[model samples]
Target chain A: MNGLLIAIKSETFIALRTFASKLIVAAPALVAAAQLLLVRLTEAGQQARDSLLGGSNFEADVANNAYGFFVDSLSTGLTMLGLLLVAQAAYSYSYERDIGSIRHILIRRVSRRSLLSAKLIHLHVLALLSVLLLLVSSYLLSGMLWEYSAIVEDGFELISESEIREEITLGIQLALLPLPAAIAFGLLISVSAQSATQAVSTALGITLAIDIFKGLLGGSGPLSLCEFPAFPDRPVLFTIRQSHSARLFRCIDR
Target chain B: MQALSVTGLNKKYGSFAVLDDLNLQIDKGSIHGLVGLNGSGKTTTIECILGLQEFNSGSITALGYPPPQLHLSKGRLVAIFDSPSLHPNLTVRQCLEHALLLCEKPKRSTEDVETLLGISRFRDFKIKNLSLGNKRRASIAQALLGDPEFIVLDEPFNGLDAEGVDDVLELIRTLNRDQGTTFLLCSHQLPYLEQICSHIAILHKGKISHSDTINNLLGNTQTILQLKTAETEAASKVLETISGAELIDIDTDGYLNIRISGADSIAINQAMVENKIPVAELILKRASLAGLFREITSEDA
Candidate 1:
C-alpha cells in the first residue's frame, strides 16, 4: 500500500511537469470549441440566404435548437478524446521503458504492479478532467450560438425543456460508458509491446479496426459496446437528435 | 555480512546459456567491480539482479530481499544504468524532485546532490538538451537523493570526462568510507575499476573465473620483463642462472621476454653486467587489472 502511494506521487509529479498530460486535458475542449464555431458560422450563412429569398420556414427554426448542436459537439469532442486517451495510455508505459526510467522506480521503492496501477489511475484522472472540460465548453458554446427551447410547431409545444435536458443527459451518460474500457485496452497493448512506437501504432490501429468493423458485427457483442462512445457515427447522438424530430412529426400527424 | 549474494544462477535464452552456475557474493561496505567482455551478459546479470527481467534458475538476495521483493527494502537499493535512465523532457532539477518522491527518507536535497555532482549550472536544463556526460551526472544525482545501502552501477564511467570521473571516484570513496555503502559496479573500463574498486570479479565463459580482493588477484600475477641486449645468447644463459627469472620467448624485435616471479629488475641488470652482456634497453611491465583480465579471458581463446 505504501509502495502504491509512492508510485502515484511519482506519476503525478511527472504529469504535472510534462506537456503530454496537459495536451490530453485541454486538446479535446479546444477542438470541440472550434467545431462549434464552424457550425454556428454555417448556420448563420444559411439563415441570411433564407431571409434574402423571403422564404422563412418554421421547421428550419425547430431544427436549429441548441440541444442538437450541443450533442453534436459532444460527439466530435468525445471522438477525439477517445483516440487521445488511447494513444496517451499506450505511450505512457512504453516510452518510459524505452528511456529505461521505469527501472529506477522499480528498483527504488515501487513494485511492477504498483507502477502499472498508478499509470491506470493517472490516465483515468486525465479522462475525467477532459470530459468535464468538454461538457462545459460545448454547453456554453452551443448556448451562445442558439437558444435552448422546446420543440414548438404552429404554436403547439411538442417536447418540454425538462424532457430535452433529460434525454440529452441520458445520451451523454451512454456515450461516456465505454471510455474506461478504451483506456484499459490501450494499457494492455502498452505492456505487451516491444517499443514505444510499436505500442502507440498497434494500439491506435487495433482501436480503428474495431471501430470500422463494429457495424458488421450487428452491434450485439461486448466489442461494439466499447466502440459506441468514441466514433462520430455513434447511435446515442443520433438517437437524441431523431427523438426530437420524431416527437414533432407525431404531434403533426395527430 | 554479505550485501548481495547470487548462488548457482543459470539463465538461458532458448538453447543458449548466458550465465551458467555463476556465483558472486559482495560484502557490505566494499566496492566490487564486475568486469567482462562485450557479450559476456554483464547487463543481463544486472537486469536479473534488479528484477528488471526474469531468470530461468537462480537464488539471488540483495539487502535480505529477493529480486521481486527488492522494493520492500524502501529505497535501500538503487541502480544507475548504462544509459541515463531519466525523463528526457524533464529538467535536471525536476528530475531530482521527481526522484525524491520515491525516497522514503531523503537524506540529501536536490541542491545538495546537484552541487555534489557539479551539475548546479545545468539544473534547469532539460535532460535531452544536456550532453551525454551531464545527463549521466543528473542520473547519478537522482540516485544519491536517498542513503542507499547497496548501489548497483552498470558502466558508470562511460560518458564522463576526466574531471567527472575523478569527482565520481571521490564521491564513491567518501560514501564507502563515511556511510559504509556497498557498491556493485559493472563496467568495461578496467583501469578505472582497478583505481576505484576494492574487490574484482572477472566473468568469463558464463562463470566467474576470478573473484577476490584487488591485492590477491594482482599480487598472484607474475611481472613480465622485456630485455633487449646485444649478446642475446649470453643474456639467456645468465637469466637461466637467476633463481626467480624464467625466459618465456624471444620476440621478432630481438627482445628477450622474461617472466619474473620474485626477482627485481636491478638484480637482472647486475647479472647481465657481470656476464659481460651489454643491455641495450629493458622495460618492466607491472601486473595490472587490465593485464590480469587479458590473461584470464585469453586462456580459452
Candidate 2:
C-alpha cells in the first residue's frame, strides 16, 4: 500500500479532467432519463388516442403509480451502470499502460499493487456516484410523470405506499450489491490483457457472454450464471422484474 | 556508493534467453550508458531494472530499494521511456501538473519545466496532438518535475531534431555536473552517448561483454593500422617482429591489416621502413565507442 494516497490523488486528478470518469457517472443517468421520458411521451400519445376513441383503460391506476416506474427506471439505470463500470474499469489500467503513463507512477511514487488498489477504489467511488445520480433522477422523473399513491380498490387500500417503498428499496439494494465484484472482475481482466481494446472487449464480452449463456443453464442448474458472483447482473435483473411484478400483482389483487 | 546495481540477472522469453547472468553497476553522479545493437536486450535490461518486466532470476536495487519497492524512493528516481508515455488526452500543462502531484517535494513548477523544455507553446495542446519531439519534451519535462537523484532514459534521442538532441544532451550533462544526478541511459546512439556518458556498458548477446569508464574502455581497445604495401609477405614479416603489433588478417588486395594494442602506429610504420618493406599506403584508425562495441559484439557472435 505504499504511495496509495499519491496514487489515488493522481487517479482522481485524471478522472476529474478526463471524459471516461464523467461518462461513467453521467451516462447511466442520462440513458435512464431518456428512457423514462420516451416512455412518458409514448404513454401520453396512447392516452390521447384512447380519449379520442372514447375507450377507458382499466389498469391505468397501477400503471400510473410512481413507485413502479421508479423501480423500473432503477433497474435499467443499474444495468447500464453495471456494464459501464466493468468496461471502464477494464479500460482504465490497460489504457494507461498502453499510453505508458503508468510507468512513471511505478518508477516514481507508486507500487504496482498500490496502483491497482487505488484504481479499484477510484472506480468504486465512480460507481457509487453514478448509482446515486441515477437513483435521484429516476425517482424525480418517475414522480413527475406518475402519481405517488397506494394501490386501492373501492376506497379500500390493497397495498400501502410505505410497503411498496420498502420492496423497491430492497430490490434496489439487491440489484446494486454485486457491482463491486463486477468491477473487480473487470480490473482482473485489465491486468491480464495486453492492450486497452483487448481488455475492454474481453471484459465486456466475457461478462455479457456469461450472462447470456447462463440463462440456458437456468435456475437450479449445476452452473448458475445468475448466481455467479462475478456476473451478478442476472440476479439484479431478476430483482428488477420481481419488483415490477410485485407491484403489478398488488394492483391485480385490488 | 552505487546508485543502481544489477547482479546475476537472467531473463528469457520461452527458451530464448534475453539476458543471461547480466550485471551492471551505475555509480552515483555518473552518467552510465547501456549501448547495444537492436534486439540485443537493451530495452529488456531497462525494463527488468525498472520492474516493468520481470526477470527469471536476479537482484536489482535502485536508490537503496528493490525494483518492486522502487516507489519507496518517492520521487527520488524517475524514468523517461522511448515512447512518449504521456496521457494523450491531457494537455502538456495538465500532464505536467499530474506528474507534479506525484512529486514529494516539487522543485520546479510545471511552467518552469514547460519553458525549460521549450514546449510552452504546446502547453495547451493534448499530448496526442503534439509532435513526437514535443511529446518527448513533455515526457522529459515530467521527469524533471522533482530533483530526482537518479534518472533512467531509454532511447532518449529518438524522434528528436538535431536541436532537440543537443538540448537533451546538454540537459543530461548539466544535471550530472550541477546536481550530481546519476543516470542510466540506454540507446544505440553511441557517439552521442560517448559525448555525455562517463561510463559505457556494452551489452552483447545476453551479458555485459565490456564495461568501464569511457576513457578506460576505449584506452583498452586496440588501434588498427591498415598497411598497404608492394610486398605483403615483407610487411607481414616486419609486423611479426614488432612487440605490440599483431597481423590479424590480409585483405583481398595486398594489404596487411594489423592491430596495435598498447603500441604506437608509428613504431609499426618505422619497423616497416627499417625492414625495407615498401609501404605503399598507411592509414591510422583509432578505436572509438562504436568500434569497441562492434568489436566486442562481433566477437561474442
The CAPRI class of candidate 1 is high
Q: Model 1, range B2-95, lDDT digits (tens) per residue?
A: 9999998888988999999999999999999999998898888889899988899979999999999999998899999999999999999999
**Pairs clashing within candidate 1:** none
lDDT tens per residue, model 1, A118-187? 9999998999999999999899998999878887878888788888788778767767877888788888
Judge the docking of candidate 2 as incorrect, acceptable, medium or high: medium
Worst 10 residues of 2 chain B by lDDT: B254-263
After TM-score superposition, the amount by which residue B139's alpha carbon in candidate 2 deviates from its true location, in angstroms, is: 1.0
- Per-residue alpha-carbon lDDT of candidate 2 for residues A46-149, written as tens digits (9 for 90 to 100): 88888898866548767777776676667678778888888998998999999889999988888888899999999999999998999999889988987788
Candidate 2: count the clashes. Answer: 0
Best by the DockQ measure: 1
